[model samples]
Target: MNRLPRPERFILVDDNEADNVFHEIMIRRAGFTGDVLIFDNGLDALAFMRQDELRVPTCIFLDINMPMLDGFEVAIQAAPLLEGRETTVLVMLTSSGSPQDRERAAQIPVISGYVTKPLAAALVRDMMSA
Candidate 1:
């Protein structure tokens, strides 16, 4: 089992405030010491990504639903931008179980995986190990 080095970065995108808070808490409780960036919408996250100094998160947890630039649209826009940086991984975290939702996520090259809502410690462990 190859574990990732310490100080891993994570970016979580979700419209719901409560979900974001819970996710953050879980990540911290897991003993993963790193910056957990939160974005309420995709546009803000994308904007931050454009900044030269913005640390590229090790993994991005994006929600399928959002106001002003949804998950799919964000992926479509941000994928190319992050391509030049090879270390980052994008995962769609959504409550959606629809095949169409998963299919849409699959279309984006930047998106590495799709996860259901309420991110668990196991999910964090697996993603960080990747």
Candidate 2:
């Protein structure tokens, strides 16, 4: 079976510094040799996403709770940009395991997945292999 292409860019939009560091390390441990962009808030991440030179096959890991804009808000605004882009995967990598949060994420067509904190290398590998 042919494996799916690994994402060329990994974008992490979370306010927690420690979580960002952990997630980045996890991505590297997964043997993903790609650009990893870390943003402390949703606005910056959205700005980078809006750039014309943004690479394809990008995976965005967004947190649910934030100061300025939350993950849901970002996903809603990003839906237009992500439309028809099969290579782009926007996932909610939040600590919240609430059913309400998951349901909200599911309502957003742009959001590909909703995962809890501490992103694992195995999951990353599976994402790449899928």
Candidate 3:
């Protein structure tokens, strides 16, 4: 994969621990040498996003289905923190490729893209460029 601009930090919000591990490897393979912050749930991720004063994430890979709060809920709640923050991108990363899900993502202003899971290095490269 071609090199892409590395974000200061990459945030991954997924309940699945194994997926987080795999995605981290993919991000690195895409030549992203930055902090990879993993969150098991949306609430924690929302909190982190709200509290972190220093840097806004370069990219946020959020799962559609998760415990304690789904990705949509997080996006909705984080919209205030995310709006007009051009450098930050919120992406829906999930196993489901349902059209309904995609439509919902469209309704959310914060979501830049909706991608299926098992994140690949190529996809990461494409996303970074996007």
Candidate 4:
């Protein structure tokens, strides 16, 4: 595994705890030696992102089908928080492989890309290298 330049911090917003754990492992496997903040829901993640004391994370792994506010909704709502944070990238990590979902995510300027579930080290490495 090759080491890539890591961000100051990383954010994972997914309702599934199992996926979060798996994604964390994948991130580590990809050699991302940075803080990983896991949020079970979008609302909390958005709140944390909006906090003045909070540093903008390098990457945000967001699941699209969360309870309170879905990934699409968060992308729309997070526009303000994302502004001026060009280094921060938001990737939609969801189980849904629907083309409709991908198209919808494409419409959202906040979303950098859409990825399927069960994040892997290779994918993490690719994302980091990008």
Winning candidate number (lDDT): 2
Give model 3 RMSD, 1 decimal: 3.1
Which wins on lDDT, candidate 2 or candidate 4?
Answer: 2
Off by over 4 Å in 4: 1-6, 52-57
Compose the digit string of candidate 2's lDDT tens values, residues 3-60. 2357888889999999999999999999899888999999998888788444467788
Q: List candidate 3 stretches off by more than 4 Å.
A: 1-6, 54-57
Instruction: State candidate 3's TM-score.
Output: 0.90
RMSD of each: 2.8, 2.5, 3.1, 3.4
lDDT of candidate model 1 versus the reference:
0.80
- Global lDDT of each model? 0.80, 0.87, 0.85, 0.82
lDDT of 4 by residue, 21-117 (tens): 9999999999988789999999999898778444544788899999989999998898888765666778899999999999999988778778898
State which candidate has the highest TM-score: 2
TM-score of each candidate structure, all chains considered together: 0.88, 0.93, 0.90, 0.89
lDDT of 4: 0.82
Residue by residue across 1-130, what tens digits does model 1's lDDT show?
Answer: 2123332788889999999999999888777788899999999999987774534446778998999989999988997677755557778889999999998888777787888888898767665655
